[model samples]
Target: MASTLTDSLVGRLVDGRYKVDSRIARGGMATVYLATDRRLDRQVALKVMHAHLADGASGADFVSRFRREARAAARLTHPGLVAVFDQGVDGETSYLTMEYVDGTNLRRRLHEDGPFAVGEALQVVGEVLDALAAAHRQNLVHRDIKPENVLLSTDGRVKVADFGLARAVTEVTSTTTGTILGTVAYLGPELISTGACDTRTDVYAVGIMLFEMLTGRQPFVGETPIQVAFQHVNDDVPVPSTVVPWLPAEIDELVCALAARAPEDRPHDAPAALVHLRRVMALLPPDVLGRRADAPPPVVSFAQGTPDDTDAPSSVGEIDKIDEIRVGGDTDEADGPVRGAGATDHLTQALDTRASGSTIAFTLPDRDRLAPATGTAPAVSTSPTAPVDADRPGRDRRRPRRRTLVSVVSILLILGALGGGAFWWFGYGPGSFTSVPTGLAGSTLEDAEARLDAAALLHESVEAFHDTVPAGEVISTDPGDGERIPKDGTVELTVSSGIEHFVVPGGLVGASVGDARASLSSVGFTAVTESGEWNLDHPEGTVLGLSVVEGESLPHNTPVVLAVSKGPEPVVVPQVQSLTLDEATEQLEPWTLAPVVVEEYSETVPEGKVISQAPEQGSAALRGDEVTLKVSLGMPFVEVPDVLFTPVAEARTILEDAGFKVEVNYFMGFLGNEVRSQSEAPGTEVRKGSTITLDL
Candidate 1:
């Protein structure tokens, strides 16, 4: 995906280390690239903001938004969410490095394959809900939940992405950038009307997505955004049964309630909604509930309905013009946006007529675990949008004695009926009893059942998170060890799953090269190093630093970091005599020696000459100091000097002047001192002031 940015980043080193490989994916706001960590020898996904978005005029706001969103998104940890690895500015370019999810966005899937089948849709929705549940728990509301933000992997895993508009819902407003932004279709009514949003807003958007999945069309559509916004506030969500007649009323109710005009009407929060969905799915007919042993199976069904009233309202006023049904304590309201009678007049004058901003305030019951709940306290206003009812009696005195007596009688009757059924089935009837068992460790559910077959005991799993136990391993049991039960009773075993422990690599902050490598290997960690200075905290050679903190359980063989010590300060290179290349370099390290290998042939010396050194070898140095080493590469040659072919007298003069001692000898025909032969051949490289013997 990062291949898209390769052209612009091919030779450019980002942050002085990341070498862009290729563009991976591109969007209007940013381009993502697969890059090589030059120092680490590993791959990473680099998301760089668009050039225009980082220009001087727009850079600051975009940077701030990117930083805040990145941090908020990072706080979330779910298998169904993309992980942000790092974020910072690389010169003028701002970028975020994130876990590269090998998958296609739902938008791409939709574009290539249109709408999904019921089974696939349910699976995707379940995973998306998982991510949303995590975010909602942290009070982060993802204002945008369109198809583009959903990603589907080949492994059938679905992940939610792009928490750009997500912000923490707190008592005080943290973000003032009132730039209302999100996909027009997915935007909630509260965000559109007052820019006041909470978890319910996300629920509404998820509901729209579910509607599209079931009906293959969005619930609301219009030619303009304002028209769409008006629809969200005034229009009742068309029942799934309306489009698909076979759709169950309960499912329709769930969808309608999630997309309720008021937040309270929705099922508490995302988790509650998800629980309801799971329950409905579990109760689906066995004929429709196909099983998958490989992964979490998908549930499927479709409601059948023909096209009915597709004419959605074009404006909020259309509601009042049609139905005068009381929604929010307002009677005689036109078929438009219903306004609470208590604050209706003032709100209409302020919002519809745009009067000098007047605040709309009310007190909601705060039923969704949203406040410091003290067992349903007195009505108190927190948000301007909440509704208040002053007439409801408080818990202290309003409950009637007659009602309590009736409820007690009713509960007693239900319990008696259940007890009678149990007595007939287990005590006096032909049904048998099973005894609970022990030693569930290292035993499969089937194995446990087989062992307890004679005792007639059955087993059931209670799913829970465990750091000291494996997922499928039982942690503890309902019946104590050795406890006896009915021969037909169920044996709930508490199995011990080995504790999940991950080795945390150390010395990564400022370790030397060798020490870093050794530390990682010793701890069974794979290390990635970035080329930069080892700062004050980390010394060279011990592990300088690591990314993930100690004790985080990553899947086996996860990569980690370790900085090693490079050793103490350097010193000047000492002179060498018979020292080998390896020995020379070792001694030179203290002086930061950088050896340059060379070769030469010498009659009086061995091949691979250490012809001598530069800076004459004794130059002073410091840590990381660079010194040049000149080693003989062997067998030096030379072109004949121009004076070689000159007469004997001239040759003698040239040889002496060139620092070569000349000798004259009478060969068979040549004169004394004539250049008939030479001991040192032409093109031979000799040290200055060294003798070059010659004969004639």
Candidate 2:
């Protein structure tokens, strides 16, 4: 029940192989830890099912999924995949042991900062596709490929996490009726519409994550999880270029294709998608391969009237109070009885005052308690205490009965006079001069307010949050749309605040460890590293993976770490001399060697055999090296002279003496048939029996 680290079951070894070191992250169904592999002397990420999920009713399903995922993920041997080392139960706890990646999640990066640079965004997307390619090849779909489930190692390699785990969990709890597991923001359209998926589902998620990274916003949004899910099924994936304007056209097409509403429209699988992604990335200029140094810092414009000193907005839990006023007087009965005009405002003000300065719960070093606000109260606040004036009746005491009756009669007489004034005001006064507009259409609150304000009417933005209305869109108007009201009367509006923003995970694909750290610091993410992969393009010491996708909704200050990648491995080209061409090609295959051959005459070497090589035996070369070989053509031979520059009588006599072939050319007397030019000079050495080219 306790969310604090001291009370949680952290620092305990599970299955005697993994020693729980610290909490890395937590979600609705599980808590993940950065643990050490005692036997292997390596670190790993251990995800333990939540106690509620490990209950007898769901335990079988959880265990089955844990095992199924191990089987499926283990089949995938790729640099982009997060390896599954082990999965088992330690007493009552069920956990999965995977390669511990050390890096921030993409979600934390976006939350700490705003948007990712175009280069960094592309890198993340491309790496994720690389990982997905491996999974899809194995016929395994990572049903949950959100930013939270994609981890970046310290070396900037992307390792996909939670492959098939969500589907396994779903299969485990078929009886229980509740929302299926997975973040709403990154769910693929097919998953939302049909509950059917393949590797393309993950591609869709990768597209969504890329969109968020580039634009610092999700493509689809709603007030409720259901509405957001519906948006996936019905709405087109909004282009991030529309939001950022600087995104490249190729990238825009790639993203749009990945998130197509219909599955048939998306890439066939992750591998195919990766091919497209790589092709698109290859087309980008070299300068776009890394973070752009010239990009100006994003303009920091806080909403008008927002406090100057408030900490940057964090996750949903960090937000203290939200006030959503109903527009107009069309208060629905379902909203409960309406309070007096000033009463509602007073309550909101009180909550706002308390929330204004409250401290947010942050992550810590303990495993099992890595997430902030794991549905528990803060440790610092004390229990409520009774006030000292509890028993006093000073205000409740009434005057004498005769005085009360006289006061009631006098109030009645005054109310009658006010009733007459209200009737006149409604029937004949200027209050009847104007009518409220019927609809705001699709106008943003800012535009609506400006238009209404210019019309000399009062405009008040109601801070109501709805599941359907986009942020800053007017939900409704005051006095009801189309209702008649007095000129200069207030036109109240219920504007959306949009879905609550959360910390972006640090380990986005392609981000370096330092970049991840900067991003987390900016967004307020605090998760610790657990494991990682080694990649060359990203280099070692950069973030390579994350538990969540970027821009996912999660608790604040989750402890995330940068999983660094090990740069590409350098291999020496193998020796291919003295071997047959086939044998040599096979031996050098591992070195990525390219073989080129040139035929030359050698005194001692046999024909069709290798004589010498440019890079001889033991000569070092990198993979993909081109090596030239000299093949033997045996000893050189020459033919006798074939002269053609002599006169017919002189040529025939010379040919017989030199043992050469000669042909005579006849010409008119003006152009004498004398020796003009010879194809080959006399006595010159030439290959045996080769025809001599002649010209007259």
Residue 327, candidate 2: Cα error in Å is 34
Best by TM-score: 1
Write one digit per residue (lDDT tens) for candidate 1, span 183-220.
54666666555556788788888888877776666677
What candidate 1 gets wrong by more than 4 Å, as runs, is 1-28, 33-45, 55-59, 111-114, 171-177, 267-269, 289-696
Q: Write the per-residue lDDT of candidate 2 for residues 1-696, one digit (tens) a residue.
A: 112366265677778778887665554445667679887677777767676655678677856755676677765555566666677777878777776666655555555566777777777887778666545544566665665555655687666666644343234324222222334466665443334556667778888887777776677754333345446766889876787676678878888978887765676666556656777777988665554323334433211012112222111111111111111233335654334433334333433343322111111111111111223566896879654464776744444567889999999989988988887777666654577776673579878877777666787654543345678887666456667767768876656665334558534667765456546534534343546664545655656676666777654334454567765545665666666667776776776667888888765676666777777777666555678988777665554444455455665565445534555444553456456656667667654334443344
Question: Model-by-model lDDT, in order?
Answer: 0.56, 0.58
TM-score of candidate 1 relative to the true fold: 0.46
**Backbone clash numbers for all candidates listed:** 87, 76
Give me the displacement of residue 286 in model 2, in angstroms.
4.2
TM-score of each: 0.46, 0.41
Residue 508 CA displacement from its true place in model 1, Å: 16
